[model samples]
Structure formats: structure tokens, C-alpha cells
Target: MSESLGDPASAEMNATAPETFRARFETSRGTFVVESNRAWSPNGVDRFYNLVRGGFFNDVRFFRVIAGFMAQFGINGDPVIQGSWRDANIPDDPVLMGNTRGRVSFATAGPNTRSTQLFINFGDNSRLDEMGFSPIGEVIEGMEVVDALYSGYGEGAPNGNGPSQGRIQAEGNAYLEADFPSLDYIERATLVGEN
Candidate 1:
């Protein structure tokens, strides 16, 4: 049978991972976790998709929090941060996936330029896929955690002061807010078995 989002059989097919990873995020405010069981190809065209599914960089921070728009994470600037592995950039995987809601995709500046930055989709963003955004997985649980981030124009925000204006910079730079709620942290992430 063909895979359909509504079918339980299809859901299992969508979770195409050999193992499961649980990302445990520890923020000053509280802890949050994201679970997954999908794998991405390391050297294949779907490499970017795989990294997000592989749980390779679990425990990364939700470095960027924008209220109402999205809460972004997946970059561990701190060397001491657990699961922060030093690795080279992976090739781009733009043509194979999309930026669907609850879907996870790598953040990029240009083509073939993804290091370790990733974000979860709060809503449908089809425009990003054409721009090279690759969806790896969907938020199986705790999406409410993903949606509760404090939204605002972060320090050095390019969009000025706006509700939808929030930015999480590449290369390990976090937002200016010292203490806030609605911000989520990936407490643990692991890859389970694929269908």
C-alpha cells in the first residue's frame, strides 16, 4: 500500500530510522525533549535530511525563540555542550523534500552549506523548500513546547521589532533574552527503527 499521512501503517513508514535518538535539552528555565526514529543519508543526496533524522547532534539548544512564528534550535556553540560534535559541512539536499509543518529541516545560508543548524516547522512553509530547505522529520510530541517560545525581535534582529521577527544566527550565536519561557530545549533525541 502507498504511504498516507493518516494511516498508522504510513506513519510507521515515515519513521524510517534504524535506531531512535532522544535529544534532552537543558535550559536555565526548564528541560524539554524531542524524540525521533528516522535516519538521513550521510553522503547521499538526502544527507541533510539524514543528519536531522540521525540524532547526530542531540542535546543542541533552541538558540532562537520567536513568539508566534517559530522557536528555532539545533546549534551547540559551547564546546562543553554534550553531543556537540565537530564535523565538516554536508552536501545540500534541496530537491527531495519540503518544509512542511512539524517537519525538521536544516538552516542554511546558501547551497551545500549546512553545518549543524536545524529547526522545527511550526506551520507550513512551502517557500523554504524551493530555497533549499530539507525536511527530515516531524515533531512526534511536544510541539506545544515548540510553540511556547517567547517571540520578539531578538537583539540585532534584521526584521526590526515585530512579532514574527526572530533570528537564530549560524556559528553558535544565541538570542539576547537571558530568562524567558515558551523557549524549548531538546532534552534528548535518539533514532529508533525504520519501517
Candidate 2:
């Protein structure tokens, strides 16, 4: 692993380094792939490798959706998908980035609870950081597809984890269920600006 994996200065040097990323979401509706832009990735390939090594984002569906507000995902409610690196939460990276529209951030139930769960901001939410929100990346494209998601409630409704109990709550309850996008899959994610 590159020492730059957690270094801030080296992140910029990685700018010229080729980078690529791939994320998959498994929901009650179906599984989908989400390609990410690495040109703007703060830590470049190092961050990408860290995410893959975490293995917490794998097959985890977006579990929360608040139209025009934000869309949260990453946690599968299974113990396997929860917690941070080494079971120790990474320090909050807020202020390093802004919570602008289309920004993807880690979700924390509280201070440093961030682990596998993440959220995409639908609007400017600067106040979020004051509340401990940390955005990791921004969406360079695909805003159109994200906006077209169906906003509905109930198990497997169509929008996201549904309204009644949310994905986290429905994880163990056999009576509850959730919904998510249909046929939504990431085509591919490759680093930009690298030769």
C-alpha cells in the first residue's frame, strides 16, 4: 500500500496518477453498479484502494433517500458492512471538502460513526459539517440519473429504503421491507487526468 493512502500532501501528487473506481449496490429491488469520477478524488487511487479493501461497500444498497435532500447508502444492516477501518473510525475529514450538491459523504450515526454507509447530497448542506458530516467526493456527472429516481414509500416501493422503517430498521424485522432503484448499475469508473 502507498504511504500516501492516508497522507494529504501525496494526494495531490496522485493527481497525475491514473485512477479508477467501481461501487455496487444491492437492494431488495435489484443490484446496481455506480461508476465514480477519480479526477476530483481527494486521495486519488489511495482512497479507492482503501474503499475496496474495506469490503463494506460491496453489494450494499442505498438505504436512505430524501428527494431533493439526500440519498444515503452503504450499510447493509449486516454486521459485515458496519464499522470503520481497524474498527477504529477515521478522523472527520470535514472542512477538507464542502457538502455541495451531488457530493458523496460518509454517514455517521454520531461523531466518527462513519464506516461503510455514505450519503449523496442533493443540495448544498454546509451546515452538515457543523453537525459532523464529512463529504469525500463529488459527482462529476450522472446527476440526471440520480434525480430521476422514484420517490415512494413502503417495502420495495421504488425510490429507496422505503418510508415505514428505513433499511436499517427493516434489516431484522421480517414484517418490514424497503425499496430502491430499478436496473440501476454503475457502468464503469476510471480515473481521469492520469496518463
Candidate 3:
């Protein structure tokens, strides 16, 4: 049977992830692997795991690729999917690790606001730990590919010229393809060992 794809509030979306597992992300640039440890952040890991299993990251853009900083993505390109997850907030996972280079953590608006967006640190961003950015995993392979993802767009709108998150959520990839055509995107993402 196919895996059930549901909103975060549903039981299928909340199913527990493995104690340790790897997720392979195939992007426009190349493929990379992130091995997540549930012990570090169970809630965050489970959400990420289910999203991959449910094929949620297909065609998602690396919208905010900050050179020498991090590459952020995970916003669904389908506005319908985006709307379903917009208010599906998950409580903050107590940060158990620092935001070192290659570490992955969910992006948040504030406390308990983490939903789908996440970033991969390109440098030591330990300072984020103090602000509650709990890392669920780190890139275990193809760090160079992660390093090479296009970053010419810089920061998101109002601050810089990159695509605005609100617009991406509202208009989906149509807005991105028209305005920011050079952005690299995830072709697909998958669990490493799932049958």
C-alpha cells in the first residue's frame, strides 16, 4: 500500500521515526544524505521523516541559499499542501545540539512555530542553539553538493531580493519560476532504507 500523506495533526503524520536513519535528497545540484537521530529531537525528526515518506519535498526550492551560511527549503510548491501545513505548528524541541556546519534544523517564526521549513548550516552557527534551533540531523554525505547549491539570490524579500516566503506559499512554484528562475530545487527526497 502507498504511504498515507496527511496534515501534521493526523496520526500518520505523527508516526514515530526510526531511532536513527538517513534521508537522501536529490536536488537540482546533486544528491545529499542527512542522518537524523530521534534522540536529539523526536518531534522534529518524526515530522521530517513522515514528510519525506509522503513525498512532500518534491520540486521544493532551496529558496534562501546564503553563501557561507545555510541553505533553507521545505516549503511545498503546491499552495494546497502549503495551506494544509500553514497552521500545523509543532512545539519546540529542546535544542540538544549546536548548529554546526551541515547540521539541519527546522526554521521557526518563534517558539513552537516550526512546521515544514528547515535549513542546513554551512558554518558554525552555535549561537542559534541559545535561541532554540534544535538540530535533528546533519549532512552525512555530499556536503560538497550542499555547499554548491545556488546562493546568488541571497536573503528573502524585504531584506533582500530572494523570493518571499509568503508569496511562495500563496502562489506556489509559479511565482518562483517567473521571478527567481535560477534557484536550485529538490527534484525529490526519500528515506534511505524504506522498501
Candidate 4:
């Protein structure tokens, strides 16, 4: 097995190496691909490249899927990894692109808080662009699969019926499967050019 992102040994790995890449996600809903341009959001793109190459997104649940809004994920399956990355934030990227439909951006609590969480916009969310949500990539294929992901739980935490981030980081997928059983998940995420 590969080292989990939460493993302290791997946590310190640099994600800043500049590289343009494409990622393919095999999900319970279906498969989709995202092509990232390094220049769009250097730090965000690099972090995502590292995560995808590290197998960090495998078996991760789509914890926050709000219809007509966005679908969010990136909490690792291992609680340890989830905890390790909770504060492993990267610097914010200037909002060079609008959060239009199919665009993917890092999810942040505030400025420079982007860690592992990412969301794919379901519609034109241009408002988020002004709020500093820089898109790292856009879905190049199978966007319908993204749209079809389960959203029955709505937003997360104290606002909606979805699972809590705290619980997810503490208990991992066990909590999600037991509580949000219908949620779609990433079975695996792979770099497009890799074997």
C-alpha cells in the first residue's frame, strides 16, 4: 500500500513543483476527467497534482453535494490523513477564472485556507470568483456524472443534513457510509498519462 497523505513522513512532501496535468476520476456515479493548467492556479494545481498522484482521493466520499451549486470532496478515507491535511493549507491563487459550470476550485474557509477540499461547480457561480475561489481546472468529460451525484443530504455541518467535517476527519469513511449511505464516492483518481 502507498503512504497515506496523513502520514507525517509524506505530509512534508513539496506540492509546489510546477506541472500541467490531467486527472481521471472513477466514481460510483461514473468517470470524469479534469485537465489542469499550471498557470491558472499554480499552488492549487500543484497540490491537486500531488494528491492525485499520491492516491489520496481513492475511496473518498463526496461529502457536500448541493444541487444547482457544487459537489465537494477531498477528505481522505483514513482519519489520520484527513487530520494531517486539515491544516496543510496552500496559498490562495488569484481568481483568474470564473467559477463557471464544470470548473473545479479549492474549497476554503477563508483566504489562504485551501487544504485538500475541492468543489466542482454545477452552474455559473461567478459570485465565488470575487470571493477568491480560483478554479484549478474544469471537467473535460462525463460532467453528467458529476451532476448525478447524490445530493439528498445537502450542505454539511450545522446547516444541513450532511455529515460533519469534524466527524469525517475523526472517523473517516465509516461515518459517511453509516450516515450518508447514498453519497457517491471516488473509487479512484489517476493521472491521465500515468500507467
Backbone collision tally, model 2: 6
Model 3 spans > 4 angstroms off: 1-6
lDDT by residue for model 2 (1-195), tens: 223323323443224323545454333444334444445433322344354443334444444466777776544334322322324344454445677887777777676555445677889888886786756566655565565544443233344346332434345222222233342222222233211
TM-score of 4: 0.94
Ranking by TM-score: 3, 4, 1, 2
Query: lDDT values of the candidates?
Result: 0.48, 0.48, 0.91, 0.89
lDDT of 4 by residue, 80-162 (tens): 77777788888898989999999999999998999899999999999999999999999999999999999999988888889
Q: Indicate whether candidate 1 or candidate 3 has the larger lDDT.
A: 3
Off by over 4 Å in 1: 1-59, 77-87, 153-183, 191-195
**Better candidate by TM-score, 3 or 4:** 3
Q: Candidate 4, which segments miss by more than 4 Å at Cα?
A: 7-12, 15-19
Error of 2 at 14 (Å): 17
In candidate 2, position 9 carries an lDDT of 33
What 10-residue stretch in candidate 4 is worst by lDDT? 8-17
1-195 per-residue lDDT for model 1 (tens digits): 122211212333234333445444344335445454344322222333244345434444565554534456655433433123334356765346556666677677677766566677777778887787766555666566566654543422344442122233222324323433334455444333331
Regions of candidate 2 where Cα sits further than 4 Å from its true position: 1-49, 53-55, 77-88, 154-195
Looking at model 2, residue 135 earns an lDDT score of 60
The C-alpha RMSD in Å for every predicted model, in order, reads: 10.4, 7.9, 1.4, 1.7
Q: At residue 129, give the lDDT of candidate 2.
A: 66
* Weakest ten-residue segment in model 2 by summed lDDT: 186-195
